[model samples]
Target: MGDFVLSGNVTRRENKLIPHWKGPHRVVVTNNGWTYDVQEFVAPFAIITRHIMRLKIFRDKYLGVTEDLWEYATYANGGHMVQRFLDCKMKFDTHQWEVLVQWRGLDEAENSWEPARILLEDFPLLLARWVRTDAKAEGMRSFVLNETSSRRGK
Candidate 1:
């Protein structure tokens, strides 16, 4: 696993933490050139972008009128075909699908060459746990941020 220095807070949209981030956070660029941000992010936030490639497929297959199919396929196929389609064609943005395609290829190449794993045996409590921060306890109404704090009480 790569080193992940505590970058900072991740913002949320619609009760979920956003995945795509800007600027220099903390990412290890793999040999293939696709970088993996080592910081711990809210689970399943990455899942949202899973269908980004599917959107490309749907756009290519069905044309622009129904990019929604990419999303629909995610539910229907149980998101199984996401990576397959992504590998075949990476489309983070249907408008500029080539960039996405290149990125996905780099990521794939890196992962295949040298895979990363959560070393549970090495660090028993490495996994992050969710914190119910939505409740400001004073935001006119309580709202928990979709984020995780270190299990260590600090």
Candidate 2:
């Protein structure tokens, strides 16, 4: 593969509630599509060869600069509370809902997915916003369906 970045694997050391996907380590070499050699700056100039499944293609916009990655990891690892809720979704298997939250003072890329109930209880304002946004989306969806049906009738 061309220049790419590797994503961090989930670890018990990290808070299980938070959705973590850290990294954008630069790839130094590639052994066809099966494996790649990457450099980890934080690991102190260490090079590692990993299978293709363990790596993700690097996107400059989403990953941002290498410096920012370190800052994000520090903030996230520090157990800082989430700043605000961005979105929410229900889990298909567990039927439990989760919210996408952005931590205070951190970049959007540092946002994590958290359990909706915990967020609602901890940050009540998030519940209000979620209700308002959901209502608006439902209204828009109904409007679209009505318009489509009217056009079909005509």
Native-referenced Cα lDDT, model 1: 0.24
* Candidate 1 collision pairs: 133-144, 133-145, 134-143, 134-144, 134-145, 135-143, 135-144
lDDT of 2 by residue, 29-140 (tens): 8778787788764645577777777777655442344444543333444456456566666678987666677786688889987775565445443344344566532422
Tell me which residue pairs clash in candidate 2: none
Whole-model lDDT values for every prediction: 0.24, 0.56
Report how far off residue 95 is in candidate 2 (Å): 44
Query: Per-residue CA lDDT of candidate 1, range 72-104, in tens?
Result: 322322311112221112234442211111122
Q: For all candidates, what are the clash counts?
A: 7, 0
Candidate 2: list runs displaced more than 4 Å: 1-4, 8-22, 60-66, 69-101, 104-154
